[model samples]
Target: MNVETETMKNEAAPEIRIGGGVPVLGPRDTPVAEVVHACHSASIDQGLAALAIPGLNRETLEPVLQYCAGLRCVADNVSCPGCKRRTEAQGIETLDQFILSKKEVIVGDGRVRLKGEGTETVTTPCLETLSKQWSGENYWFWARRVIRKLRHGLRRAHMRGEPVAGEGETPSIILMEPQLADNIGMVARACANFGLDDLRLVSPRDGWPNEKARIAASGANYIIDDARAYGTLEESIADLNWVGATTARQRDLRKPVLTPEQAIVEMRKRISRGERCGVLFGRERNGLETSEVAVADAFIMIPVNSRFASLNLAQAVLLTGYEWMRSDAGRSLGRVTTYEKPLTEGLYLGRDRPATKEELLGLFEHLERELETNGFFNPAHRRSTVSQNLRTLLTRLNATEQEVRTLRGIVATLSQGKGRARKREE
Candidate 1:
């Protein structure tokens, strides 16, 4: 059963409220109803009644725990629907009904009806509802402690609960002779971060299922739990058809030294040829030996500074994996946000076509009239050159028909001042 349900079994009244905001220790046999009445009469927070119990044991007063423990399908402040129904059936009301009793309450999105009284339907309990009810500092302090203790459990409800592996032609990440379990865990985390799940460890130093490694991995338990340990690098990548060793050094070996992008493209080409591929990342302290690099088909080099060309085990894995995903044609590059119709047509802008030669000439004539009237052309001989230059500039802009019309409208507005004045004088 839950903590709240376990605490309800203990039959005891909370502290009795004396006059002047003082609390008198009630007997162990005091009823919950009397305790609630005293809290209401003394203007005390009803949830604070649990504080009256000596030593403040949560196990004994779990029913009155207002803030949510943040477990799966559970929340704070708002009463559980199951608990509410049970208590309502027992003829008990008001207690544990702090948020639900309100006729209407405001949440994050908008307003919500607490009861089935209005046209709007009663909304489900969410973060907004929980945050609204328990506004006490003391309550929040306890709530934070509870949340920290059960932080991992909070995501249990939303988790898919499946090992992420073998979606398509994903390259496996093989770590050769890793020293630290924390590094292994971090590598696993990086693999998970980039959707590369196949983690093969070649004889980790601290052994498999290391607690420190799991702790370092945080919530990436899937990669850690499914991590396979092999005796050697050869055994680790034996199932793979091709292998790429990631190193920062420039060696004298005859093997092709390819950048991360080139390595990923080669791996993809090999994958398309119905061959499995894996990238070998050496230990954290010293990277793969020259002999070990010889086994790989290519050397995957990250273009870093030549002076300090070293990367952490997880960093190398992450970079290579990112490049692999980048080169993979299956994955979408970014969020797709294309409209069904053409932008100009959907926006209802008149003249979706480009400006024709006739329309362009008409706009040029209209603008030339204004420029001539305003004495923009200082000399008549330079007028043709100036007009040709203007036409060339306008042509370079590739302004649409709508844009040409807009320029014409602007020219008409600026040049109509004298005509308006003459008409007024007439």
Candidate 2:
């Protein structure tokens, strides 16, 4: 669930090449879509080169239409890499669909990524209420930035139900297909109160970047890391040795919907036996869908009025989590920090600058050749100050990883005898 932060990214256009090999366009002329399309094609180099040339207009892209008119045969053989093992059987028909959808196109290498048209908006009861609470729910819109941060944090590191250790118990909280951002945040708060750090949201309906969720989470934001969002109900409950389903209406499920007390007793028994198990909760409204109850090992229900039974999202999570805690499994398992890249030494005056070894050597070598070629360096008497000053100037700029690579190449070119001869000829 990576959120798209910036709108209208300016990408370099694609490059054109003949069918077999050969580049035809300069970098500026490369078509952006062609480069993106090549990501799906067979060969990257050839694909990139092909992208440089403009494809026929959408109306003119049909090979069959072109062939029928005796212009050119359209190639329908290319397949989409996203769904592999399946060739693009739709041909021109599929192309029309893509045009209609206006999918994102980025070309390079032999792989093309399609951030398909926006996700479908489900018209659930939750949507209407969520819209009222946190405004609209567009993942890419500028108004929804906090939501993007949450999405970024989740994607940068994989989240899981943290393992339990020591003689303490672990807390459990379930979020059934939370569709709105605010609901997820409120659920996080409920977990915080009952000492439940782990959360499971099944098949998130709204996707991610839910600002309402972050605003609602308040202080208990870290559980967002422990919150594991799944694609299906079974997947959400798979790891739990004991499962409890939250529902209001009576069902044919053999398992009973015990009050919070009865459910806690069973959960405690399971935990005492040193087993992993949890009590589940359904979405705020519409409760648990029929399919969700099918896989439950047991059922847990919150009794409400027969006519009006809607409860706040946080209230439900708290109810279930509070029940789980009663069984002696609702203690903090201690905080574990997951680090992304480890720390490293930077370029220093005494220890030497970053890329302290090879990059420095390359930089010096490059500088000497450039000076010599431009007649800037007096060969008869080399002045150390000149070279040192040059280094100081470049180091201050803090050249980027790519800039350094390019500079090194320039130096290597100027240092070669053939290069010098060619320079003289030019």
Query: TM-score: which candidate is best?
Result: 1
Write candidate 1's Cα lDDT for 363-425 as tens digits. 999889889999999888899999999999988877789899888777776777657734533
lDDT of 2 by residue, 131-248 (tens): 3422222211211232233234322233233333332255356677776677787888777666677777777776653434545676565666557777877777677787777777
The TM-scores of all predictions, comma-separated, are 0.49, 0.40
List the pairs of residues colliding in candidate 1.
68-76
**For candidate 2, what is the lDDT?**
0.53
Q: Which stretches of candidate 1 lie over 4 Å from their true place?
A: 1-168, 177-197, 204-231, 250-253, 326-332, 336-369, 395-426
lDDT of 2 at 91: 34
Q: Rate the local accuracy (lDDT) of all candidates.
A: 0.63, 0.53
